[model samples]
Target: MAILVLGLALWVGAHLFKRIAPGMRARMTERMGNGSKGIFAIALALSVVLMVISYQRAAFVNVYVPPSWTVHLVDLFMILAIALFGLGSSKSNLRGKLRHPQLSGFALWAGLHLTVNGDLASVVLFGTLFVWAFVEMAVINASEPRPTPYTGGSTVGTIRLLVISLVLYAIITAVHAWLGVWPFPG
Candidate 1:
């Protein structure tokens, strides 16, 4: 649990460093030049590894038992979450509609996980990430001006995005099932 918390803290700190301490981040970036991104990437990778390892080993101390019905909801909402996740990078028209679609998707992913996982470890892990995504959104929204909406994506692009999102979601479900957690309620 301690390691999990540490991992979560590292994840949050690495992400928020630039927003929380602009001067310090600037100084580091100035010194490291292009390598600064590598540094952050390494930190994020390490944090994820730590969190994954710790979470797998964590004892299942129940916090609350989610109703079985949420299983179906998780599947449905996850499709939306996955689509929102791809919106930022996809050629879909909705790409420009949201300033932080990726973060919004990440938060949605984390929050949705909580509906099915009620253990303390799951709460701490997903809950912290959920909050961090919102905090990140707030910080970025404050620092940047609202973006102009784009008007140029074709319906084909959106259809392509949906297809890709659905495929990725299917793959993700397969991975979870391989790990012994089937997402769909039997």
Candidate 2:
């Protein structure tokens, strides 16, 4: 629990720093030059390690038994979450319209996972991500009032979106198999 909490704090704190202390982040970036990316990469790597360890430790504690249907819902939501994430990240028609599609995808993914996972670690991890996504989205929306409208839907963009979404879905499915956690249990 300590590891999970600390990891969440580090991950969320790093993200929130930009929103909470924009000036500080700007000053640091200016001081660090391109090294800011290195700092961020290190922070991200550390957060992932902490999260994995925390989640492993948390598996010992059984908080609640989730309903079976929750898994199905999670699976469905996860697909949408992936599609939205790809659309958000890719140079697609959805990008300019949503202003923060990645954040929205994070919210959806975290919220969906929370519904399926009823454990202390799951709650902490998913809840923190959900809250962070909401806060980040709100901050971004406030900072950028008007969204830059997309020009027009492109056939190439649509194809790219579909291909990326399918590839990611396949990769996640493979990862699930490798981890021996069949999200969609037979």
Candidate 3:
């Protein structure tokens, strides 16, 4: 739990650094020059590794048993979450309208997972992500200079986004068994 908490703190803190201390980020970027991205990559990798290890260690503690219905609901939510994430990355009107579709998608994903899994590990992982996403969204909205106009995209782009998201979701679902947490358990 200590490692998990520390990982979450580092991950969330690094992400929120820009929002909390914009000047500090600028200073680091100036000092590191092009190496800032490398430093960020290393931090991200370390956070992920720590999170995974901590989650696995903490999984032995069960906080609450989730209802069976929640599994089905979570599947539906995950589909929507994936679609939102896809659209968020694409050059679609969603980016302009939402201004932070990725963050919204992340929040949706974390929230949905929490609904399905009532455990200490799940709570620590998903809850932290939920909070981070909310803070990130707020920061992004506040940082935007002005409301950008939405630009409509072609039907092809919309279809492509849907297809990509569905494919990615399917791939992840397939690998869930290997991850030892099947999202769809029969």
The model with the greatest lDDT is 1
Error at 157, model 3, angstroms: 0.9
- Ten contiguous residues minimizing lDDT sum, candidate 3: 88-97
Clashes of each: 0, 0, 0
Q: TM-scores of the models, in the given order?
A: 0.96, 0.89, 0.92
How far in Å is the alpha carbon of 182 misplaced in model 1? 0.9
Looking at candidate 2, what is the lDDT of residue 90? 68
CA lDDT scores, all candidates in order? 0.93, 0.79, 0.82
**Which rank order by TM-score, best down to worst?**
1, 3, 2
Residue 28 of model 3, lDDT score: 86
Q: Candidate 2's C-alpha lDDT?
A: 0.79
- On TM-score, the candidate that comes out on top is 1
Q: Give the residue spans of candidate 1 off by over 4 A.
A: none
- What is candidate 1's lDDT per residue for 4-66, written digit by digit as tens? 999998899999999889999999899999899899999999999999999999999999999
**What would the per-residue lDDT of candidate 3 be over residues 91-129, giving only the tens digit for each residue?**
654556676677888899999989987889889899999
**Reference-based lDDT, residue 185, model 3:** 53
RMSD of 2: 1.9
